[model samples]
Target: MPHADTLTVVHHDDTRTSYTDVRYQLHRDGIRIWSDEGEHALTDILMTHAYRQREARAS
Candidate 1:
């Protein structure tokens, strides 16, 4: 089992024939933080995390 506070990514391919129909869900402690079907979803999440970390260090 994953840790309670662990961030997890659940991915699904809506169409087996192509990679364009993809979905992503971001969860923490079994609760969803956000979900997106766009191709840039993972990149957006990663960048957001990086931005938060940088802000935390600056404070």
Candidate 2:
């Protein structure tokens, strides 16, 4: 997975190149994760919980 500031070249060849933007956007009540599959919109509470969960696992 790529962080918000990281830009990745997901696909590249002779004729075409594709770059993936791993960034999140903050909104009034939620955050949005851009993806090729679909955009994931999470409320503030859920975003906080996800961050906490990742922190707990890292610790």
Candidate 3:
């Protein structure tokens, strides 16, 4: 699992992307995900652990 403060990136399209925060609900009904663009259901957010990666930094 990602750390609470970690920023998540979602690809909305081939040329569009969104950064979001994903958290579990207090009641455990489901997860909550949101970004500057908007919010969406956990089920609506498609992701894969195998595809996740850390951002590279320049020296």
> Which candidate leads the pack in lDDT?
2
**Candidate 2 residue-wise lDDT, 9-53, digit = tens:** 221232321224344566777655666656666553222211211
**lDDT by residue for model 1 over 1-59, one digit each (tens)?**
11122233333432222222123244542222322333333322221111111112211
| Total clashing pairs in model 2 | 0
Model 1 RMSD, rounded to 1 decimal: 11.9
Lowest summed-lDDT stretch of 10 residues in model 3?
43-52
**Ranking, lDDT, top scorer first:** 2, 3, 1
Candidate 2 Cα RMSD after full superposition onto the native fold (Å): 13.0
TM-score of 3: 0.28
Instruction: Write one digit per residue (lDDT tens) for candidate 3, span 9-48.
Output: 3333423233434332322333454445565454333332
**Model 3 off-target regions past 4 Å?**
1-27, 44-59
Those runs of model 2 whose alpha carbons end farther than 4 Å from true positions after fitting are 1-21, 46-59
Looking at model 3, the pairs that clash are: none
Shift of residue 22 alpha carbon in model 1, Å: 23
Worst 10 residues of 1 by lDDT: 47-56
Best by TM-score: 2
Candidate 2: C-alpha lDDT:
0.39
